[model samples]
Target: MTIPEQIEAYLTSQPQAKRTDLRALHALMLQAIPGGKLWFEDGKNSEGKVVSNPSIGYGTRTTTYADGKTKEYYQAGLSANTSGISVYILGIADKAYLAETYGKTLGKATVTGYCIKFKKLADIDVEVLEAAVKDGVGMTGEN
Candidate 1:
């Protein structure tokens, strides 16, 4: 399936309440980063073991490993996990910036180095989340 199709399938597969929440988040992400490349990760390793929740991603970034190999991934991503939803902001060099800048204002979410997570959209300040997302995109995106 295509990336969009995969994302729809992933979102639709969620439990109804979670699906509604994630769908809203997905739309928010799109509005935050319009025209960005879309991506879908099935959360599988090369061996087909499920390593994480499948994620819908936006934009692009090239990630380099300590071994000097590189891989391409999205700058922002969304996923539904066991407890809640996670929003990932990749490519930021400062590990503490996100949590430090937006944690308190983000409402009930947990702001980590690269992820902001909450049980549902209604639990957080959507505007604050949007600002954080835009901030992350600006910090990590190619100029």
Candidate 2:
């Protein structure tokens, strides 16, 4: 299926509350990065074994490893987990940025190096989350 179709399917598979939150987040991400690329990963390995939760992704970034290998990946990602939802802001150079900048201000969410996780949208400040996403996109020059 196409990326949009896969994203829709992934959102539709969530519990009602999570589905609603994911949809809202999807819209917010779109607003943050207008015309950004979209992606959906079914969380499968080459063998088709389930390796992670399905994720909906936005924007693009080219990551270069120390070994000089590079990969093009999403700049941001959204996913639903058994306990909550996760927002991934990829390609940040400073590993301490997210936690240092948004960890306390993002309400009840857990802010890590590249991920902001919360149980629900209501548990966090959407505006702060938006700012974090915007910063992430800007940092990657993807916005």
Candidate 3:
């Protein structure tokens, strides 16, 4: 399936409320980060075993791992988990930036080094999330 189809399938697989939230988030990402590449990761490794939750990715970044391997990956990512949804802002140099800049203003969401997690989109401030996503895109030089 294509990336858009995979994304649609992922969103449709969610419960009604979650599906709504995920769609809104997907739309927000598209608008906030222009000219970005859309991606859907099935959470499978080379062996095709699921290692993480399937995720929707936006934009792009080239990252160098600790092992000195460089990889082109999504600048931001979104996923639904058993407890909540996860929004990832990758390629931030400062680990504390997200939490420091948007944590308190993000309402009920949990902001970590590169992730914002929340049970419901209603519980968090969508505008704040948008700012963070745009910032992530800019930081990755994709904006």
Best by lDDT: 3
Global local distance difference test of model 2: 0.91
Off by over 4 Å in 1: 66-68
Clashes of each: 0, 0, 0
Pairwise lDDT winner, candidates 1 and 3: 3
Q: Evaluated with TM-score, which candidate comes out highest?
A: 2
List lDDT for all candidates, in order: 0.90, 0.91, 0.92
TM-score of each: 0.94, 0.96, 0.95
- Per-residue accuracy of model 3 over 1-143 as CA lDDT, tens digit each: 98999999999999999999999999999998777899899999999999999999998888888999998889999999999899999999999999999999999988899999999999999999999999877987763
lDDT of 1 by residue, 9-63 (tens): 9988999999999999899999999888899999999999999889999888888
Segments in model 2 whose C-alpha atoms lie over 4 Å from true places: none
Candidate 1: residue pairs that collide: none
Worst 10 residues of 1 by lDDT: 134-143
